[model samples]
Target chain A: MNLLQKFCTRINLTKSSKGYNVSVIALLIILLLIGIFLSISIGSSKISLADIVSAIRLKDQGSNNYRIISFVRIPRTIAAVLVGCALAVSGAILQSVLNNSLASPNVIGVNSGAGLFFILTAAFFPVNIYLSTIAAFIGAILAVFLVYFIARKTGASRMAIVLSGVAVSSFIGAITDTVLTLKPDTMIARAAFLIGGFSGITMDKLSFAGVFILIALIASLVLSYDMNVLALGDESAKSLGLNISRIRFSSLILAAILAGSAISFAGHIGFVGLIVPHVARFIVGHDNRLVIPVSALMGSIFTLLCDLLARVLFAPYEIPVGIIMSFLGGPFFIYLLVKGRRGQLYD
Target chain B: MIKLEDISSGYNKITIIKDINISFNQGTITSIIGKNGCGKTTLLRTASNLLKPFSGKISVADKPITDYSDKELARKVSFLPQLRSVPNITVYNLVMHGRYPYLGFSRTPQKHDKEIVDRAIEEMNLASYVNKNIQELSGGQRQKVYIAMVLAQNSDIIFLDEPTTYLDINHQLEILQIVKRLKQMGKTIIMVLHDLSNALSYSDNICLMEKGQIAIYDSPEGVYKSGKIEEIFNVCSQQLAVADGTKQYVFYIE
Candidate 1:
C-alpha cells in the first residue's frame, strides 16, 4: 500500500489502504450515467428506455427515435461531458500552480483571450471552425503569458496576479467588442461567443474538441504528482529539486488548451472551471491525482445535468446551458469566498 | 562536505552576496549569524542550489552543484525555506512529499517510504498530530512539521533558513535542541540564525556576516575572541557556564 492510501485508510476504515476511496468516484460515474440515460430518453421527443435499448441493440433499424438519438442528443450530451471535463481539470491545475483558489481560465483571461482571437478568425475566415479553434489555442497561450508577464514584474504577489488577470481580461473584452461593433456581419461568431449553448452540435465539432480535451485530460493526469508538490509553495518545491518554472509553464499550457477548446466550441462558459475543482477538492481531500480525475468526472456529470435542466425547464423554449451554469456557479462561487474565511471549500 | 568557492548570488542580475568562499565540514552544525539583510539567507539558499550564483561555483562532495538534476540534488541535500504558507494538507501528506525524489508519477509510497515518514514524524515528536491539518497546529508545531518533512527526505545535508524565527522562547530552545540532535545523528547542518546565544551554544561553527560578506568564520570561541561580534551586533556580550558544561552567551544592548 502507498502512503497516501494509508492516510486515506484512516477515513475509510472498512477499505484497505491499497484502494483510496474510489466508491465516491463510482457514485459520480453512476450519477453521470443516469443523467446521460435521462438526457437521451426524455428530451423534446420522449423516447423510452426500451427504444434506447433496442436502438443500442440495433434491432430497430427503421426507427425515427434511433435517428434522433444517434445524431442529435448523443452529440449534444457528449459535448457537455467534454466541456465539463476540460474546464474542471484545467481549473484544478491552475489553482494549484498559481497557488490561488480563484485562478481559473475564465478568471485569468484565458477564455476571453480565446474568445477575442476566435472572433477575429471568424471575421477573417467565415464559418471555419478549425481556424477558429487554432486561433483560440494561440490566443489562450498569449493571454497566459500576458498574465505571467505582469506578475513576474512585481514579484508575483497573489493579489497582484489577480489584478493582472482583471487587466488582461478587460483588455481582451474591449478588443472583442470593438471588433464586433466595427463589423456587424460577424454575428455568426458573436452568436457563438455571446450565448454559450449546445443547441446544434454536429459529429465533426464534437470530435474536434473531444480529441483535444481527451489529450489534455490524460496529460494532466500524468502531471498530477508535480501539481501536488506545487501546493507546498514554489520555494519549498524548488528546494526539493523540482523545476518550478518548467512545471508552472507546462501546466499552464495544458490548462489553456483545455479552456481554449471549451470556449472555442461553447461561448464563454463562466463557472464550470471555477467551481468544479473546489467541489472535487472538498470530496477527495487535496490529492491532485484524485482531485484532477474527480473534478473531471464531477464536472462532466454536473454540466450534463445542468444542460438537461436548461433544455427541459420550459418545453419548446430552451434557455442556454451557460445561463443555468452561471445561475448555479455564481452563487456557489460567492459562497465559497464567504466560507473561505471560515476555512471551508478552498485549498 | 559542501564547498562554496567565492560564490555570488542574488535576483534579477543584482548581486546580494559577492565573492563568498567557504567549505562546510561534514557532520557539523554551522549557524550563520548576521544583521538583517546581510545575505545570510541568500548564501544558504545559493549553497543548496536554490538560487543560482552570479559568479563562482559550489560543489558538494567533489561534484559541481550544477551537475546534479533536481531529483539527484534532492537526494543529496534537503532545504527548508522560510515558512510562509501552512499548506492546507495533513502532516502525513506533507511528510510524504519528501519522497518525491524516489517516487515519480503514479507510484504511491510503499512500505519503505511510509516507515521513513513515520520515523521523521516521530523524531520531530509530531506523531500525535500526524493526521492534523498543518493550519490547525501551533506555530512551533507547524515548524516541526516542516522539519519532519526534510528529515523524511533523508539527505546527507540539510539547509534551514531562519528555522526558529517567530517562535516563542521555549519553542526556539526546543528547535535548536532538535538541530543539535540532528547534528549528533551525523547530518551536515547549515542554517541562518538570528539568535546569537543559540548559535554560540548549539553550533560547532559560526559564520558571521557584515554588509553581504563573511566577516568572521570560525569556531564559537574563536569568533567570540575576535572582538568583532560586539561591533557588528552593537551589543555587549557576556559568557556564562550553565548547569551543563556548555557556555552560554548573553547579549545586552549597550
Candidate 2:
C-alpha cells in the first residue's frame, strides 16, 4: 500500500507539470471565444448574443443593424484577430532569432522602418493602400537587412543585432518625425494610421491581409524545429546538422513579412507584437512549436478584447486599439521584466 | 573508419591546418594532442565537416563526406564542439535533440526514441537531474549531458573537440570512463585532448601534432618510447610499473 502510494505520488507530480500546459491552452481558448462574442455584441447598438447569432446566420429581419454587424463590425473583428496573430508570431520569431528577451518588431526598428515608408508613400504618392503596403513591406525588409549586415561581424551576435536595430530604428524615426513636422496635413493622416484603429477596415483589405498572414503563419510553424535548434547557438546547431545560415535567413524573412503586413494595415500596433509572445512563452515554456501556435491564438484573442474595450470604454468617441493594448500590455510587460530579472523563467 | 587525405583547412584567406593525412581506425579511441595554436581544434572541425577544407578530401567508409546529404552525414557521424556557453534547457530535452536527424520535421520524439534518450541519461548518471534545467547543472554534469546528447545520436563515429576543458580531475576521469565505454561498444571515437596523461592513458592511438603537421601517430607505448614526447611536449617521463603489471609513464619536472 505504501509503495503504491509513493508510485501514485510520483505519477501525480509528473502529470501535474505536464497538465499545466493543457490547462493554460484551454483557458486561452475559452477567453478567445468569450472575447469574440462580446466583441460582436458590444457596439453602439448593444445587441444581444441571440441577435448577433441570428445576424450571423442571416436569419434576422432588422434595420441597417444587420448590415452594420455583417459588413462593418465583422470585417473589423477579423482584421483585429489577423493583425494580432501576425504581430505576435512576428515577435516570437524575432525574439528567438535575436535570442534576447527584449527583441520585437517595435524595439528592433522593423515597425519604424515600415512606418517611415508608409508616411513617405502617403505624402509623395496617391495613397493607394496596396502601394503603401508594398512600400512598407520593402522598407521593413531593407531595414532588417541593413541591421543584420552592420551587426554581423564573423557571425550573428545577439547584443550587436539588438543595439544596431535600435540605432537604425531611431535614425529612421527621427526622419519620419521631421517629415511629419514639415507637412501637418500628412501628419494628421499618418497619426490616424500610426495610433492604430480597426474602425475603417473593409472585407477586401481583411481578405488580402489574411492571405499573407496565413502564409507567414504556416512558414513559421514549419520551421519551428529549426528555431528551437537555433536557440542553442550557431556552433551547436551546426554540429547537430542544421544549416545555420539558411535557418537564420528564413526566420528573419518570415518575421519581416508578417510584421510588415500588420504595420501596413494597422499602423504600428505596439504591444501585441512585443507582449503576446512573451506571455505565450511564459505559459507554454520555451518550445517554439508550441509557442508559435499558442502565441498566435493568444495574440488574436488579446487584440479582439482590446478592440472591444476600445469601442466601449469611451463610447461615441472611439479610442485607438493600440492605446488600449498599451494600457493592458504595459503593466503585464513590467511584471515579466521583473520576473525575468529575478530569474523566475530561466529554469 | 574515418580518413583525412592531405587536407588543408582554415578560415577565409588564412590556413590553420595544412596537409593533414590520417585515418582513424574503427572500434578504437584516437586522441589528437598538441600545444596551443597547433590547430588541434581546426583539424577536428575539418574532419567533422564543420569547416570546409581548402584542399584534399575526407571520407567515411570510402564515401566522401561532402557527398553525403546533411541528414545522411548526421546519421553516420556525430560531433560535440568545444563548450562555450550552455543554453537554458533541460537534460531530457537536450538529449532528445540528438535524435533530430532521425525524426526529421516531426519534432516530437517517439516512444522508442524516448527510451534511447532515457538510457543515455541513465548511462550518464544524470537521472536525478534529468528534469532540471541544463544551465543549473555543474560544469561536469553539463559536459556529461552533452556527451549523452551525442551518444543519443546513435552514430558509429563520434568526434569531440576539447571535451574536458573546464573539468576537475575526478570529473575528467569520469568523462574518460564514458569514452572508454563508448570504445568498448565498438564505436569509433576521436577527440582532441589537452591533458597529455589522460590522452596517453585512455586512447588506443595518439597523434601528436605541431605547427599544423603530424609529429607522430602511433600506439601510446610506441609514441612514448620513441623519445618524441620530449620534442612534441618538451617534457621527459619515467616509466613506472604498477602491481597489476601495467606500465605507466610518470613525467618528471625539471
Candidate 3:
C-alpha cells in the first residue's frame, strides 16, 4: 500500500473512525475524476481532452465543442456526480440511523415519495423547477416520517423499518400511478422525471440542488460520531448521552433533504443510494465518518460510469440512467435482502 | 447524589418500575438487587435519565435531572446498559466514544480527552487489547471495555447494569473491587446486580427489590435483619461472619 493507503488505515484515538484512511477515499476520488472526464469527453459528439479543456476554460466560446461541453456534457456530468453523492450519503445515514443495511431511500419509499410529489407538482403547478424541488423535499420527508411512524407503532424493530418502507413505497406508487392516469397531459412533461436521467439537465437546476446536497453532506460528516454511537442500539446510545429520538429525527430530515434534492434534480434515481453506500462500506468499513465521504465519492464514480454506459452504449438511443441503475441495482438489492436476512451484511 | 421521587418508569407507555422514591447517597456503592424482571434495570435507567419516569421527578446534585442538558447530565452521570449491540470497532474507538458528550460540534476529542481514554483503558487492564477489534475479545473482556467506557466518561455518578454478569468469579470480584476504588475516589456508583451474594458483600447499601417496588433499603446486615429478604426471595437467611469480621448473609430458598 502507498502512503495514502497507509494513511487511510491509520487509527485515530479521538474519534470513532479509524482515521481518514485515504487509500479507498483517494482511489474513489481519482475514480470519480476519471469518470467525470470520461462522461464529458466520450459522449456521442466526442470532444478531445484539449478541446474539452479549452471549452471548459471558455477559450473556445460558442464553438461546437464549447456548446457540447457547456450545454450538454458539463451539466449532465455535474448532475450525475452531485445526484450520486446526495443519494449515497443520505442512504448511509439512514442505514446507520435505523441500524439496517436495507435502509436506503429507494428501499424505504423516499424515492417513491419524492417521485409522487414531483408528479403532483408537474400536474398542478406550471413546469417550475423550484416548486418541484420543494414538493419533492416535502414528499421525501413525509414518506420518511410515515415509515418511521409505522415502524415505531409496530415495535420499531429493525425489520419493522424495512417492512413499513415497502408498504409506504407501494402505497405511494399507487398514488403516483393514479395521478398520472388522471392527468395524461402532465405525463409528457414528466416522462423523463419518472424514470431518472441526467440527459437535458441544466446548470441552473444542478447548482440549486447541488448547494443543498453539499450542505447535507457536510452535516452528515459532522454528525457521523453520533451516528456511530447510534449504531450501538438505542439503550446503550441513550445511556451514553445521545438523545436517540432527536438524532433519529434530525438524521431523517437530513436524509430526506438529500434524497429529495437528488430526485428533484435527477428524477427519482434508484439503487445508486443503496448500492454505492454498500460498496463504500466494503472498502471503508462501517464507520460513518469514512463511509459518508467514501460513499459520496463512490456514488459519484459509480453513477458517472453508469451514465456513460447509458448515454453512449447504444449510439444515440439513450436510456435513462435510472433504468440502468435499476437493472444493476435490482439484483444487488435482492442479494442484499437475501444476504442481510441470513446475517451476512453489517447492520 | 441522585434522588428519584415517585418514579414510575418503563417502556412504550407501560410502567415496569412504579412509584420509586429513593436517593442514592453520594460517594458510595449502592446495588439494587432483585430477581428477573423485577425492574432493577429499569430503575437504574430511570435514575440515570435513560428512561423517563412516567410520573415523578429526578434530581441529581440537588437539581432536576431533566433541567440539565443531556450533555450536562452526561458529564455528571454515566450509565452502562446491560444489552448493547457490539459494533465491529476497536477497544480504543469504543472507549473514545465516551468523550462524545464533552466533544463540540466538530465531535473530535482533544489531546486531554485522549489522555482520559488512555487512562480508562489502563484502569480497565485493557492496555494490550486497546488496538484489537471488539469481536476479538472474550465476553468478559468486552464487558470490561464497556465498563471502561463508562469510567472514561469520568462522571460523578456511574450506573452499571449487571457489570459482573458475564465475568468469571475472579473477574467479578475484581470489578466489585474496582467499585471500591471508585467509591474511595468520591464517585457515587449505582449498579443492578442479580447476584445477591456479591451485592451483599460489595455494596455499601443494598436496595432489596420485589416486583417493581423497593422492599427495603439498608446495609447488608440491616436488610437481613429487616426479614424482607426471607419474604421477598422465599429464602431463610442466617448471618455469618467472614474472616474480615463483616457479616455475610447465607440464604437458602425453601
Best by TM-score: 1
Candidate 3 local Cα displacement, residue B82, angstroms: 0.7
Residue-level lDDT tens digits of model 3 in A210-264: 8888898888888888999988788777767788777887887788888888988
What TM-score does each of the candidates earn? 0.93, 0.91, 0.90
Question: After superposing candidate 2, which stretches have Cα over 4 Å from the reference?
Answer: A1-18, A106-109, A145-185, A339-342
**TM-score per model for chain B alone?**
0.97, 0.96, 0.95
lDDT of 1: 0.84
True interface contacts retained by model 3: 0.68
1 versus 3: better DockQ goes to: 1
Give the Cα RMSD of candidate 3. 3.7
Model 3 earns a TM-score of 0.90
**After superposing candidate 1, which stretches have Cα over 4 Å from the reference?**
A1-20, A58-61, A145-164, A332-341
lDDT of each: 0.84, 0.82, 0.82
- What is the DockQ (computed on Cα atoms) for candidate 1? 0.70
- Residues A1-347 of candidate 2: C-alpha lDDT, one tens digit per residue: 13422454565633225665565567678987887777877888877787787887898657576887888788888888888889999999988887876678865567888888888888888558677777877788788887777777645567777888888898998998998888666786677667877888878766766788899999999999888887877667777778777788788778888887787777778888778888777666687887898898999999998999899889988998888998998987787667564343433
